[model samples]
Target: MTYCKVCSLSGEHPGIVLDEQQVCNVCRLDSVGDLLVNYRYTQEVFEKFQRAGRTEGAPYDCLFMYSGGKDSTYMLDKFVTEYGKRVLAWTFDVPFESEHAAENIRLAKERIAATFVVDADDDGIKKMMREVFNRPAPRKPGNYLDEKLPCVSCRTFFVIRAILHAYRHRIPYIALCADPQQILTMESDVRRIVRGFYEAFGVALADDLFRGELEQLLFAHDDELPQIVFPFIAMRHEYDPDLIVAELKAKGLYASSPMETHCTLFPLLNYYSFTHWDCMFYKLNASSHARAVKRNGADGARSTFSLKFPRSLNVLEVEERLRTVTLRIAKGEGAAEEHEAALIDAFRELGTSEEAGRFIARSFLEMPAVAADMGIRLT
Candidate 1:
């Protein structure tokens, strides 16, 4: 009668054994270790970028994906001023981005006198995001690492768009600001990039109904995009966030507004991810955020949906935000509370009330275990 809590396997299934609590062996193994491996590959990637003549002998070395955030600001400064690379800065101007982020973009351009390009079509972006959020792909296996929500899909759209832009302009490389610790890969080879994309998407998504919607909305007319290069991936984890923020501010690159974000859904998505997947995204992000604040030497501002933000965001806050946004889009303003209640009721109707309750308790207990498994030390 014992059952596995993870994949829901029972004693009737093969390789099942009952533990003291009558849970199956599969669920018991969850406590053995963290599933995803941690790695530092940035330095290796950076060295490759240097050897490949990323900055020397090219008309324009690369296209930088600038988000006008503290990290990207420092990245742009490093690429152009420090590395002596000819660069074109690009921003995907999603409508949900705070006004402050937009101002930061303007400030970065002014400060660097760098050439900039912006792609600002809100309707298309919103539609694509909605489709991604609504689709249900096969749940990721426990050992396989992924973002807890579809927000990763949103990031992918931006990345693909940037690559397509680089391809159209004949740029050989597109630079991104992903830290090595974040991605766990030192791959800078174009073949690796293409293969990774295909592997992540091709088979699992081939017959997915959402694939059609994604293609229609985001990739109807596909163009060969330039190879993505992560120059920072090769640098050692020596760039402290606080130091970078301070340096940028000294260069007159200050936060344009308090509590603004380049990606509107980042906080909310992180919150949901932590809740459902036992992923400590914000904690991971907090390390970088702390660096930014220290470098800026200013009072740290909270992310839009962070508990440390102006208003403490608890589970209720998460529910309220999601309910409000979804209802505003579906029914218009002033229906948020009603919508929130309705969604909660629907969960109950689906008999997820106890499931949700258990998930919350398990997530809290499992987080430390998962973190330990991943070799991520929580201070």
Candidate 2:
């Protein structure tokens, strides 16, 4: 039950090897001034993007992946009003989208002036998810779930689409509205990760856009790579998650915190990652927030959601920290209880493959076993 005083990471996991100082590896590995270096580099990239407007008759300067979340909503406005980039905003609606998130999408479409597009490619989404979810759980959870198998597989699918969309439209930029935690991750590894994704999938997926066409985009030389944009990183934008959520709500651009704002299946997904993988994916991002807090005093704007330590680890306890952030969500951003229904019920409604559904059901059953092994009790 040891916790890093700086970042609040548990020592149960391998990556969280806490030293005698009670500081986790996350804080220990953070090189001084890396954030500043990243800030300067991304700023320079943004400047080049500003100067490299529209690839010589290109329809738009950037193809922004707008999830109708706070970050994308704010960035959509920033690109149009401030950056003055002709944006083609794209929303890929997954079946498990939160009720509030959908409403936010509707509101944003009205307020944000951009060439908006929605792709509820249920067939595509489910097909890839089935492939990802149906895979056998590893015998031993490696590196404490840091690999984030499910999240990575799903994201690579969308990233493949983004690259394909930008290439087809001749757009030079694809903007990913990642939070600072995500922005802080190894940005350089993205190409390798995407390339490995394709390699792992092996033969073609037998789906549109996911076939072999993605290879050209990802496999291209560094100079030939389509411009990828991380808006928060590029601008070194001040991050205040609570403030962002409040502003969006005031503008009628949001539903509420947690449940309706983020993906409905978020809690379910994290549960699976924890039981089967021995770690939660969101912990990676939360660690980034922990690093920020350690370096910068708990500035009001920088204060994260309450990510305090637990007496021990279990589903409910770890899930709380996971909720502090999601994909594109920062650590300690929103309220909890994002979904009320049993996670199994929600998965049944949207989940496609029977085998994948069964895996999830079994995973939930094993949660107690996982906690028991660690001498922790599930509530």
Best by TM-score: 2
lDDT of 2 by residue, 6-58 (tens): 76667765445778999876677644377667667666766787787456868
Q: How do the residues 148-179 of candidate 1 rate in per-residue lDDT, one tens digit apiece?
A: 33455556656656755665566667787765
TM-score of every model versus the real structure: 0.55, 0.71
True-vs-predicted CA distance for residue 171, candidate 1, Å:
1.8
Error of 2 at 115 (Å): 0.7
Least well predicted 10-residue stretch by lDDT in candidate 1? 304-313
After superposition, the stretches of candidate 1 with alpha carbons farther than 4 Å from their true spots are 1-45, 51-58, 121-124, 136-147, 185-227, 256-259, 267-379
Candidate 1 TM-score, true structure as reference: 0.55
Residue pairs with colliding backbones in model 1 are 34-373, 42-233, 42-234, 43-234, 46-234, 241-291, 242-291, 242-295, 246-295
List ranges where model 2 is wrong by over 4 Å: 30-41, 139-141, 144-147, 184-193, 206-209, 218-224, 278-281, 284-379
By summed lDDT, the worst window of 10 consecutive residues in model 2 runs over 305-314
